[model samples]
Target: MSGSDSAAATSRYSAFLFDMDGTILNSIAAAERIWGVWALRHGLDVASFLPTIHGARAVDTVARLALPGVDPEQEAIGITLAEIADVEGIVEISGAADFLRSLPADKWAVVTSAPRDLAARRMKAAGIPVPAVLVTAEDVAAGKPHPDGYLLAASKLNVDARDCLVFEDAAVGIAAGEAAGATVMVVTATHFHPLASPHPSINSYETMFTEIDSDGLMLLQERGA
Candidate 1:
């Protein structure tokens, strides 16, 4: 969806939840920084990890990089920390800061896989302000691709899952939103040319934003009046 599409989507709901990393923040530099270091350390295939772990959690990514008996968790964390340390290059996506600032604080929140410190670091590096409610990996027993994180964001917003909409960068995130019963908006953080994506989603900014009921905006949109 284009910027106009975001205006349209926002007019349709009461609450909005955003994903960090590829969705609203550009941390590819930070990620690549970390992964490349890990790849060098383990002599593992960096190319394979790139295609596989974009939206994946650190623990999961690490566990998947087994090299004929190499442990995944042990490997994934080493990469994640290195990535976290060199986050000087993180930046917010175009229009992300503007859109976030336009919404009411109470109506929006962030749900991300980053542990709190890393999330803060990336947000700072990107010049994106942290929201009132940020659901991190520490907050959930399960992470993305699991409905736990999305559901947690909705709960914090004090809205029903049906009333919440989510913006995401990965298939796992889209799946998680669908499971949570929130509308999912997909972005190109995971891949470029979002319009050509085989996945179905809302908005071209590739965002799913909702009004916080200010001036009855959300309600008005819902009634289609």
Candidate 2:
């Protein structure tokens, strides 16, 4: 194996809960398909709009697509529906399925910004099982950056928030996990700048992460011991 590949395989962690989009699945293709439609309908250039939508929830996605005349909440539903229908480009995250299957299911679950329908469609398209506990947009009164979703996931797992480890690709999701009293792990899907919006920059486990796996995902962090 190559030097870089060697370092990746040796990475380790204790317990892990992975995020679906961007983190464990490459959803840009399907997301782009839906967002592109939003951009065109709003007269905005698709390229310019894609970056801003990376970490946003459906309400945020819809709000941005709404522009001035449209109601953001109403438009978010359309975007959500369009996304569910546009499952053409959805795929599992890099090394995500293998890593997930390699680990025990009771120790992990998926926490997503996408609503139930969209999450189901994408998971099916990506050939990944629907996580035992799905904390979708419908589950949380507020999405990421609010901590509700992460908190609920940990609670459902019967694990203390501080004992849970979260694998998130978005700054908001990371913030949510951290805020919910859990250890937050940042998967380097994009440059740090996007995540630079918040979250303390972490290089080691210290008080932040118990340990991160080869893929930058935290594992075994939620152990009760």
Candidate 3:
């Protein structure tokens, strides 16, 4: 849900947790280009695969779509390498860099489904600052929707899960954030349709404002209010 009142009501999150790919980085085109190639190699339908691919790890996605003989780990690694090299379409999500800059770096972290190396590469490619505490696919036994990554990120930031706020663009990531006991805010760029979830959402960080007041961290609407 979004509007002047909702944005005005959003304030005082202890810490910020962000999903990388669709939330902070606009890597959908790059992802589709690489995953599409891998899908064809395995004879999987791209149309059916794209919907389930976002916010999921390569290994998990490979396991879900791989043919009988396909080695999930090997295919996952291959796809990771391809994505690292295919940086053509990778770019920072609008207002991402500026929003992050407004926060205390120690109070925010990136929780991504991408592996450590790939996540780093994408952040660098998009000119987004890499967080000191990054929870990647390899850092967790499970990925989004399980809350492991988000929990780990909060722990690493030395913040309580309930005190955290998460920004995400996929249903799985949203589930993870909520499961982690944080308020989840949906980003509408990657998610084309209206969000049906209960959480508040913003189309971009451009519409939001961050301020550190005596009460702690507060996020407000730049214009909606």
Candidate 4:
């Protein structure tokens, strides 16, 4: 790694905020299946519709593409219900469970654009324990790229937004983290569209480990270090 890259990775923070899907949980397969079916049913192009789905609430996606006179809210609810029942391929991102388990529960949270129930179901399917502070779509008036959810999570954790590190995979979630004044780390573990941010990025948590210092400060480091 370059000097600047190493420097960015070694930076410390008081707390961490994470996006659920694509970051902590690998729900891509399930998401694609559900959204693809939904798109076909709506007479929309699956390829064109999939790009706008991630990192945003289903309701928002529906509102953006639903045909005239289609109830966006109802359509979103149907998608959510279907997603909750469709956990066929849901799994925790590699090393996500270990990384989270090593941290003090109070020092991290999940801020997702999914409804609470759907988020809970996904986590359960992936065998991830529900985080102590979960900011779901229903909890915020605005979704990702709005900063409401991330800000709410930092507030709940009693950590300053500036002292929080955020892990995300989607552009919208990165925007939210940046807007909330947190250092955003893009997770490259999944196949995601390119992001234009200059934040440090990680491809896998598998070779990383967390340590708590004598001062009770936690830091994430590479495994061999």
- Report the candidate with higher lDDT, 1 versus 4: 4
| Clashing residue pairs found in predicted model 4 | none
| Cα lDDT of model 4 by residue, 142-198, tens digit | 888999999999999988888888889998998999899888888877765555557
Question: Best candidate, lDDT-wise?
Answer: 4
> Please, what is the TM-score per model?
0.81, 0.75, 0.93, 0.93
Worst 10 contiguous positions by lDDT, candidate 2: 1-10
Model 2, position 148: C-alpha lDDT score? 85
Candidate 3 lDDT over 1-225, as tens digits, reads 373336324557778899999899899999999999878877878998877889999898888664798888898899999999988878888888888877788889999999899999999998899888899999998887899998998899888878888889998898999889887888887776676777777777776667777867655446555
Winner on TM-score (1 vs 3):
3
* Alpha-carbon runs more than 4 Å astray in model 2: 1-15, 64-66, 189-225
Give the least accurate 10-residue stretch of model 4, judged by summed lDDT: 1-10
Model with the higher lDDT, candidate 3 or 4: 4
Candidate ranking under TM-score, highest first, comes to 4, 3, 1, 2
- Tens-place lDDT per residue, model 2, 1-89, is 11222322233433456667877777887787887877788888888887767655878666645477788788788888888878886
Cα lDDT, all candidates: 0.71, 0.67, 0.84, 0.86
Off by over 4 Å in 4: 1-7, 192-194
Query: How many angstroms is residue 21 displaced in model 3 relative to the true structure, after the best TM-score fit?
Result: 0.9
Clashes of 4: 0
